[model samples]
Target: MRSLTESDIRTSFVNCSKGEAQRLSVPRDLGQLPWADLDFLGWRDPGAPDRSCLVAEWRGGLLGVTLRFPPSRRGLRHRSMCSLCLTTHPGGGVSLMTARKAGAAGREGNSVGLYLCTDLACSLYVRGRKVPESGGRLEESLTLDQQIARTTGHLSAFLDKLYA
Candidate 1:
Protein backbone atom coordinates (compact mmCIF):
# COMPACT_ATOMS: atom_id res chain seq x y z
CA MET A 1 0.00 0.00 0.00
CA ARG A 2 1.11 3.56 -0.63
CA SER A 3 0.22 6.87 0.93
CA LEU A 4 -2.61 8.45 -1.05
CA THR A 5 -3.82 12.01 -1.47
CA GLU A 6 -7.44 13.14 -1.41
CA SER A 7 -7.31 13.41 -5.21
CA ASP A 8 -5.87 9.92 -5.48
CA ILE A 9 -8.65 8.52 -3.36
CA ARG A 10 -11.36 10.32 -5.25
CA THR A 11 -10.04 9.47 -8.68
CA SER A 12 -9.55 5.82 -7.76
CA PHE A 13 -13.20 5.14 -7.20
CA VAL A 14 -14.56 2.88 -9.95
CA ASN A 15 -18.11 2.55 -8.67
CA CYS A 16 -19.25 6.11 -8.28
CA SER A 17 -19.66 9.21 -10.37
CA LYS A 18 -16.98 11.91 -10.31
CA GLY A 19 -19.31 14.35 -8.57
CA GLU A 20 -20.30 11.76 -6.01
CA ALA A 21 -16.73 10.80 -5.29
CA GLN A 22 -15.77 14.44 -4.98
CA ARG A 23 -18.50 15.06 -2.43
CA LEU A 24 -17.89 11.92 -0.31
CA SER A 25 -15.61 12.27 2.69
CA VAL A 26 -12.04 11.12 2.35
CA PRO A 27 -10.13 10.17 5.49
CA ARG A 28 -8.57 13.14 7.25
CA ASP A 29 -5.45 11.22 8.30
CA LEU A 30 -3.97 10.48 4.89
CA GLY A 31 -0.51 11.71 5.88
CA GLN A 32 -0.47 9.71 9.08
CA LEU A 33 -1.47 6.32 7.65
CA PRO A 34 0.86 3.38 8.14
CA TRP A 35 0.89 2.51 4.45
CA ALA A 36 3.38 -0.34 4.80
CA ASP A 37 0.94 -2.19 7.03
CA LEU A 38 -2.21 -1.65 5.03
CA ASP A 39 -3.59 -3.96 2.37
CA PHE A 40 -6.15 -1.23 1.79
CA LEU A 41 -7.12 2.09 3.32
CA GLY A 42 -10.60 2.27 4.81
CA TRP A 43 -12.55 4.70 6.93
CA ARG A 44 -16.01 5.66 8.09
CA ASP A 45 -17.49 9.05 7.22
CA PRO A 46 -17.71 11.10 10.39
CA GLY A 47 -20.75 13.11 9.28
CA ALA A 48 -22.65 10.10 8.00
CA PRO A 49 -22.45 7.14 10.32
CA ASP A 50 -23.63 4.73 7.65
CA ARG A 51 -21.08 5.80 5.06
CA SER A 52 -17.65 4.20 4.80
CA CYS A 53 -14.83 3.94 2.23
CA LEU A 54 -12.11 1.52 1.08
CA VAL A 55 -9.30 1.86 -1.44
CA ALA A 56 -6.58 -0.57 -2.58
CA GLU A 57 -3.98 -1.04 -5.26
CA TRP A 58 -4.89 -3.80 -7.69
CA ARG A 59 -3.37 -5.03 -10.93
CA GLY A 60 -1.01 -2.07 -11.18
CA GLY A 61 -3.78 0.42 -10.53
CA LEU A 62 -5.86 1.70 -7.67
CA LEU A 63 -9.48 0.88 -7.05
CA GLY A 64 -11.77 2.37 -4.43
CA VAL A 65 -15.28 1.84 -3.22
CA THR A 66 -17.73 3.74 -1.09
CA LEU A 67 -19.72 1.64 1.33
CA ARG A 68 -22.83 2.02 3.42
CA PHE A 69 -23.43 0.33 6.75
CA PRO A 70 -27.08 -0.06 7.43
CA PRO A 71 -27.91 0.30 11.09
CA SER A 72 -28.08 -3.11 12.72
CA ARG A 73 -30.72 -4.37 15.08
CA ARG A 74 -28.60 -7.26 16.33
CA GLY A 75 -26.13 -4.88 18.06
CA LEU A 76 -24.01 -7.21 20.22
CA ARG A 77 -26.03 -10.38 20.57
CA HIS A 78 -24.33 -12.32 17.78
CA ARG A 79 -20.78 -12.64 16.47
CA SER A 80 -19.69 -12.28 12.83
CA MET A 81 -16.52 -12.74 10.83
CA CYS A 82 -15.06 -10.17 8.43
CA SER A 83 -15.07 -11.54 4.93
CA LEU A 84 -11.82 -9.69 4.10
CA CYS A 85 -9.41 -10.01 7.05
CA LEU A 86 -11.26 -13.02 8.45
CA THR A 87 -11.25 -11.56 11.93
CA THR A 88 -14.06 -12.55 14.25
CA HIS A 89 -15.92 -9.81 16.06
CA PRO A 90 -18.13 -10.53 19.00
CA GLY A 91 -21.25 -8.48 19.49
CA GLY A 92 -21.85 -6.10 16.59
CA GLY A 93 -18.33 -5.13 15.65
CA VAL A 94 -18.70 -6.78 12.25
CA SER A 95 -20.73 -4.67 9.88
CA LEU A 96 -22.42 -5.56 6.64
CA MET A 97 -20.96 -2.90 4.33
CA THR A 98 -22.31 -2.49 0.82
CA ALA A 99 -20.93 -0.68 -2.20
CA ARG A 100 -22.93 0.21 -5.25
CA LYS A 101 -21.92 -1.84 -8.28
CA ALA A 102 -19.71 -0.04 -10.75
CA GLY A 103 -21.06 1.88 -13.75
CA ALA A 104 -24.60 1.55 -15.08
CA ALA A 105 -25.62 -1.22 -12.77
CA GLY A 106 -24.79 1.03 -9.86
CA ARG A 107 -26.71 3.86 -11.45
CA GLU A 108 -29.64 1.45 -11.67
CA GLY A 109 -29.42 0.90 -7.91
CA ASN A 110 -27.37 -2.32 -7.71
CA SER A 111 -24.99 -2.96 -4.82
CA VAL A 112 -22.54 -5.51 -3.33
CA GLY A 113 -22.06 -6.20 0.36
CA LEU A 114 -19.58 -7.95 2.66
CA TYR A 115 -19.32 -8.54 6.37
CA LEU A 116 -16.32 -6.56 7.55
CA CYS A 117 -14.85 -4.85 10.61
CA THR A 118 -17.17 -2.11 11.73
CA ASP A 119 -14.35 0.41 11.90
CA LEU A 120 -12.68 -0.90 8.71
CA ALA A 121 -9.61 -1.88 10.70
CA CYS A 122 -9.06 -5.26 9.05
CA SER A 123 -5.48 -4.46 8.08
CA LEU A 124 -4.48 -3.65 11.67
CA TYR A 125 -6.30 -6.68 13.02
CA VAL A 126 -4.61 -9.01 10.56
CA ARG A 127 -1.19 -7.51 11.27
CA GLY A 128 -1.65 -8.21 15.02
CA ARG A 129 -1.32 -4.49 15.61
CA LYS A 130 -4.87 -4.23 16.93
CA VAL A 131 -6.99 -6.64 18.91
CA PRO A 132 -10.73 -7.07 19.14
CA GLU A 133 -11.81 -5.21 22.25
CA SER A 134 -14.23 -7.84 23.54
CA GLY A 135 -11.54 -9.98 25.20
CA GLY A 136 -12.48 -12.86 22.92
CA ARG A 137 -10.37 -15.36 20.98
CA LEU A 138 -9.24 -15.51 17.32
CA GLU A 139 -7.76 -18.96 16.94
CA GLU A 140 -6.33 -18.92 13.42
CA SER A 141 -3.37 -21.18 12.59
CA LEU A 142 -2.38 -19.46 9.34
CA THR A 143 0.87 -17.52 9.10
CA LEU A 144 0.92 -13.75 8.78
CA ASP A 145 1.61 -13.66 5.03
CA GLN A 146 -1.01 -16.28 4.34
CA GLN A 147 -3.56 -14.35 6.36
CA ILE A 148 -2.71 -11.17 4.47
CA ALA A 149 -3.01 -12.95 1.15
CA ARG A 150 -6.43 -14.32 2.06
CA THR A 151 -7.69 -10.91 3.09
CA THR A 152 -6.44 -9.28 -0.09
CA GLY A 153 -8.01 -12.02 -2.17
CA HIS A 154 -11.39 -11.45 -0.55
CA LEU A 155 -11.24 -7.74 -1.29
CA SER A 156 -10.10 -8.45 -4.84
CA ALA A 157 -13.11 -10.67 -5.36
CA PHE A 158 -15.37 -7.81 -4.31
CA LEU A 159 -13.61 -5.44 -6.68
CA ASP A 160 -13.92 -8.00 -9.44
CA LYS A 161 -17.65 -8.01 -8.91
CA LEU A 162 -17.75 -4.26 -9.19
CA TYR A 163 -15.77 -4.31 -12.44
CA ALA A 164 -17.79 -7.20 -13.83
Candidate 2:
Protein backbone atom coordinates (compact mmCIF):
# COMPACT_ATOMS: atom_id res chain seq x y z
CA MET A 1 0.00 0.00 0.00
CA ARG A 2 1.05 3.57 -0.69
CA SER A 3 0.29 6.82 1.10
CA LEU A 4 -2.76 8.43 -0.44
CA THR A 5 -3.77 12.05 -0.68
CA GLU A 6 -7.29 13.24 0.19
CA SER A 7 -7.90 13.91 -3.46
CA ASP A 8 -6.95 10.35 -4.33
CA ILE A 9 -9.20 8.93 -1.65
CA ARG A 10 -12.16 11.06 -2.63
CA THR A 11 -11.76 10.30 -6.29
CA SER A 12 -11.33 6.59 -5.72
CA PHE A 13 -14.84 6.10 -4.37
CA VAL A 14 -17.00 3.97 -6.71
CA ASN A 15 -20.38 3.49 -5.08
CA CYS A 16 -21.37 7.05 -4.38
CA SER A 17 -21.92 10.24 -6.30
CA LYS A 18 -18.93 12.53 -6.71
CA GLY A 19 -20.57 15.10 -4.49
CA GLU A 20 -21.15 12.53 -1.75
CA ALA A 21 -17.53 11.47 -1.84
CA GLN A 22 -16.46 15.07 -1.56
CA ARG A 23 -18.55 15.50 1.56
CA LEU A 24 -17.51 12.29 3.33
CA SER A 25 -14.94 12.48 6.10
CA VAL A 26 -11.37 11.33 5.44
CA PRO A 27 -8.86 10.57 8.13
CA ARG A 28 -7.04 13.67 9.34
CA ASP A 29 -3.72 11.88 9.88
CA LEU A 30 -3.30 10.54 6.38
CA GLY A 31 0.44 11.25 6.29
CA GLN A 32 1.08 9.37 9.51
CA LEU A 33 -0.87 6.19 8.70
CA PRO A 34 1.01 2.89 8.46
CA TRP A 35 0.66 2.57 4.72
CA ALA A 36 3.28 -0.17 4.37
CA ASP A 37 1.29 -2.37 6.72
CA LEU A 38 -2.13 -1.77 5.24
CA ASP A 39 -3.78 -4.15 2.80
CA PHE A 40 -6.41 -1.46 2.33
CA LEU A 41 -7.21 1.88 3.94
CA GLY A 42 -10.50 1.84 5.82
CA TRP A 43 -12.21 4.21 8.21
CA ARG A 44 -15.57 4.88 9.77
CA ASP A 45 -17.02 8.36 9.44
CA PRO A 46 -16.68 10.11 12.74
CA GLY A 47 -19.62 12.38 12.12
CA ALA A 48 -21.76 9.55 10.79
CA PRO A 49 -21.19 6.42 12.82
CA ASP A 50 -23.10 4.22 10.43
CA ARG A 51 -20.96 5.21 7.47
CA SER A 52 -17.62 3.59 6.62
CA CYS A 53 -15.28 3.35 3.66
CA LEU A 54 -12.51 1.17 2.27
CA VAL A 55 -9.97 1.78 -0.46
CA ALA A 56 -7.47 -0.59 -2.00
CA GLU A 57 -5.18 -0.89 -5.00
CA TRP A 58 -6.55 -3.51 -7.33
CA ARG A 59 -5.67 -4.54 -10.88
CA GLY A 60 -3.27 -1.59 -11.24
CA GLY A 61 -5.83 0.93 -10.06
CA LEU A 62 -7.39 2.20 -6.87
CA LEU A 63 -10.76 0.74 -5.98
CA GLY A 64 -12.87 2.14 -3.15
CA VAL A 65 -16.27 1.43 -1.68
CA THR A 66 -18.59 3.21 0.70
CA LEU A 67 -20.19 1.00 3.34
CA ARG A 68 -22.94 1.32 5.93
CA PHE A 69 -23.45 -0.71 9.07
CA PRO A 70 -26.18 -0.87 11.65
CA PRO A 71 -25.77 1.14 14.79
CA SER A 72 -24.08 -0.66 17.63
CA ARG A 73 -26.23 -2.27 20.31
CA ARG A 74 -24.76 -1.39 23.68
CA GLY A 75 -23.92 -3.95 26.40
CA LEU A 76 -23.84 -6.98 24.14
CA ARG A 77 -20.60 -8.94 24.09
CA HIS A 78 -19.65 -11.84 21.89
CA ARG A 79 -16.63 -13.31 20.17
CA SER A 80 -16.43 -12.75 16.44
CA MET A 81 -13.90 -13.15 13.65
CA CYS A 82 -13.14 -10.88 10.74
CA SER A 83 -13.82 -12.57 7.43
CA LEU A 84 -10.94 -10.80 5.71
CA CYS A 85 -7.98 -11.38 8.04
CA LEU A 86 -9.33 -14.21 10.21
CA THR A 87 -8.48 -12.29 13.38
CA THR A 88 -11.01 -12.73 16.17
CA HIS A 89 -12.18 -10.05 18.51
CA PRO A 90 -14.46 -10.02 21.52
CA GLY A 91 -17.56 -7.91 22.19
CA GLY A 92 -17.98 -4.94 19.87
CA GLY A 93 -14.73 -5.43 18.02
CA VAL A 94 -16.36 -6.87 14.91
CA SER A 95 -19.01 -5.29 12.71
CA LEU A 96 -21.12 -6.36 9.81
CA MET A 97 -20.16 -3.85 7.14
CA THR A 98 -22.14 -3.63 3.94
CA ALA A 99 -21.40 -1.85 0.69
CA ARG A 100 -23.94 -0.89 -1.90
CA LYS A 101 -23.46 -2.67 -5.21
CA ALA A 102 -22.08 -0.67 -8.07
CA GLY A 103 -24.10 0.36 -11.17
CA ALA A 104 -27.86 -0.09 -11.46
CA ALA A 105 -28.04 -2.67 -8.73
CA GLY A 106 -26.94 -0.06 -6.22
CA ARG A 107 -29.64 2.23 -7.48
CA GLU A 108 -32.05 -0.58 -6.71
CA GLY A 109 -30.76 -0.94 -3.12
CA ASN A 110 -28.66 -4.07 -3.55
CA SER A 111 -25.61 -4.46 -1.32
CA VAL A 112 -23.12 -6.98 0.12
CA GLY A 113 -21.99 -7.40 3.70
CA LEU A 114 -19.03 -8.98 5.52
CA TYR A 115 -18.04 -9.37 9.13
CA LEU A 116 -15.04 -7.10 9.58
CA CYS A 117 -12.97 -5.48 12.30
CA THR A 118 -15.05 -2.74 13.83
CA ASP A 119 -12.22 -0.28 13.56
CA LEU A 120 -11.23 -1.43 10.09
CA ALA A 121 -7.71 -2.41 11.19
CA CYS A 122 -7.51 -5.99 9.96
CA SER A 123 -4.22 -5.32 8.21
CA LEU A 124 -2.59 -4.17 11.42
CA TYR A 125 -4.07 -6.98 13.52
CA VAL A 126 -2.97 -9.67 11.07
CA ARG A 127 0.58 -8.30 11.01
CA GLY A 128 0.73 -7.94 14.81
CA ARG A 129 1.02 -4.17 14.64
CA LYS A 130 -2.23 -4.23 16.59
CA VAL A 131 -3.87 -6.85 18.74
CA PRO A 132 -7.44 -7.85 19.46
CA GLU A 133 -8.44 -7.07 23.03
CA SER A 134 -10.02 -10.45 23.78
CA GLY A 135 -10.04 -12.84 20.86
CA GLY A 136 -6.67 -13.29 19.13
CA ARG A 137 -5.09 -14.79 16.07
CA LEU A 138 -5.24 -18.53 15.70
CA GLU A 139 -2.01 -20.52 15.77
CA GLU A 140 -1.31 -21.52 12.16
CA SER A 141 1.50 -23.13 10.20
CA LEU A 142 1.24 -20.58 7.39
CA THR A 143 3.91 -17.90 7.21
CA LEU A 144 3.19 -14.16 7.45
CA ASP A 145 3.25 -13.72 3.70
CA GLN A 146 0.85 -16.62 3.32
CA GLN A 147 -1.50 -15.10 5.85
CA ILE A 148 -1.37 -11.81 4.01
CA ALA A 149 -2.15 -13.56 0.75
CA ARG A 150 -5.18 -15.19 2.31
CA THR A 151 -6.43 -11.88 3.64
CA THR A 152 -6.07 -10.16 0.30
CA GLY A 153 -7.73 -13.08 -1.42
CA HIS A 154 -10.79 -12.62 0.81
CA LEU A 155 -10.85 -8.89 0.15
CA SER A 156 -10.56 -9.42 -3.60
CA ALA A 157 -13.52 -11.75 -3.51
CA PHE A 158 -15.63 -9.15 -1.70
CA LEU A 159 -14.55 -6.42 -4.08
CA ASP A 160 -15.34 -8.68 -7.03
CA LYS A 161 -18.97 -8.78 -5.93
CA LEU A 162 -19.14 -5.00 -6.22
CA TYR A 163 -17.66 -5.12 -9.71
CA ALA A 164 -20.29 -7.63 -10.75
Q: Tens digit of lDDT per residue, candidate 2, span 1-164?
A: 99999999999988999999999999999999999999999999998889889999988889989988886663447678899998888777788999999889998899999999889999998899998886568998999999999999999999999968
For model 1, the superposed segments whose C-alpha errors exceed 4 Å read none
User: Where in model 2 is the C-alpha error above 4 Å?
Assistant: 74-77
Query: Per-residue alpha-carbon lDDT of model 1 for 32-100, expressed as tens digits?
Result: 889999999999888788998899999899998999988877756578888988778877788898899
| lDDT by candidate, in order shown | 0.87, 0.91
Local lDDT at 38 for model 1: 95
**Candidate 2 clashing pairs?**
none
